[model samples]
Target: MSTHVEGSTDLKYVSDEAFIDTGVRKVVSKGNWQQQYMSLRSFPEGDRNCYKIGVTTGTKYLIRASFFYGNYDGEGMPPTFDLYLGASLWDSVKTSSSSDFTIDPEIIHVPQKNHIHICLVKTSHGIPFISAIELRPLDNSTYQAQTGSLALLDRLDTGVSTWTR
Candidate 1:
C-alpha cells in the first residue's frame, strides 16, 4: 500500500524519542505546494536528524521528500541541507528560491529491514526542513537492477563537446 505522510500529521512511524518541528502556513499561491509542513524541531543542534519509518521488509518502494520554504521562520531565508536514506546519502535539499517548492525522488529501494531511516543533516549555510514525505510501493519490474546488491549508475561526460573548455 502507498503511504502519503504529511509532515503536519503525526504518526507512529516517526520516532517519539526525538523532536521535530511541525507547523502550518498560509500559502498565498496554491498549486503544487502544500500549505503546511513539518520542519526540524531544532536547527544546527544535532549532527544528523533522522526519520524512522516502518515498512514491510523486502518491499520495494519509491520515496519522495518535498520542501517548500514559505518563510516559516519569518526571516525570509530558506535553509540548505543534506538528505540521507539509511546510512547512504540520498540528495541535497538546496532551497535556492524560497518561493519554489523542491522535491527529491529516490528510485526503487528494497529495504532488508522492517524500517528505513530518512535523515537530514545541517549544512554550513542553513538549517534543514521537510514539507512532506511520500512512499509508494513498486512492482518487481520497476527497478529490477536495484533489487539486488547493485547500485544506481551515474554517468558524467567532461569532454569539450559536453562541457565548456
Candidate 2:
C-alpha cells in the first residue's frame, strides 16, 4: 500500500476519518462508519490509499489491502483494523481476523458476487498503524474516476481537445 500523502505512510491515514487523536476513540457500525474526514484523527485528507483498494471475494479475485503497518504483534495502540470492499450500500461486507493478509496482486479468481469486507478485528487479535490498503479485483486500472463524475466530465473542460481523443 503506497502512500497517497508523502509523510503519512500509514494506510489507515487515508480517509482522515480513521482517527486516533480526534477525541473519538473508535470507528465502527453495523454498516455505516465514519465518513467525515475532518472528524477523525490519524487519517489524512485524500483517498490515495483507497486507490489500491478493489473489491471481490476470493472466488473472483483476492483483496490485497497493502497498508503500511501490520495488526500482528502486540504493538499497535488500538489493536484493530477493518475493510469495506463494496462500492454501494448494499454490497457492504466485513472480515474480523487476528492476522494480516498479504498484498500481492494475483490472477487467482473467486466468487465475489456481493461486496467484499476485510475487517481487522480491532480489539483483541492485533493492531497496526496503517498508512495504505490495497484490495484485489479482476480489473481496476481505470476505476479511479467515480461514476458520478461522468456527468461532471461531460460538462468539464481542460481548454484542450487533443487529450479527449
Best by TM-score: 1
lDDT of 1 by residue, 22-124 (tens): 3222333423543334342334557687778888898788776767666666666778788888888788777745456655545457888999888888878
The runs of at least 3 residues in candidate 1 whose Cα sits more than 4 Å from the true structure, single-residue gaps closed, are 1-32, 35-44, 146-165
lDDT of each: 0.61, 0.31
For residues 1-165, could you state the per-residue lDDT of candidate 2 as single tens digits?
212433443333345243222222233222322232112122223221222233344333433433322222224433333333334221111223323332222112343444443332233333323433333344534334333211111224559777576
Where does the lowest 10-residue lDDT sum fall in candidate 1? Answer: 19-28
Q: Residue 10 of model 1: what lDDT? A: 50
Highest-scoring model, lDDT: 1
- Give all candidate RMSDs, comma-separated: 8.4, 15.8
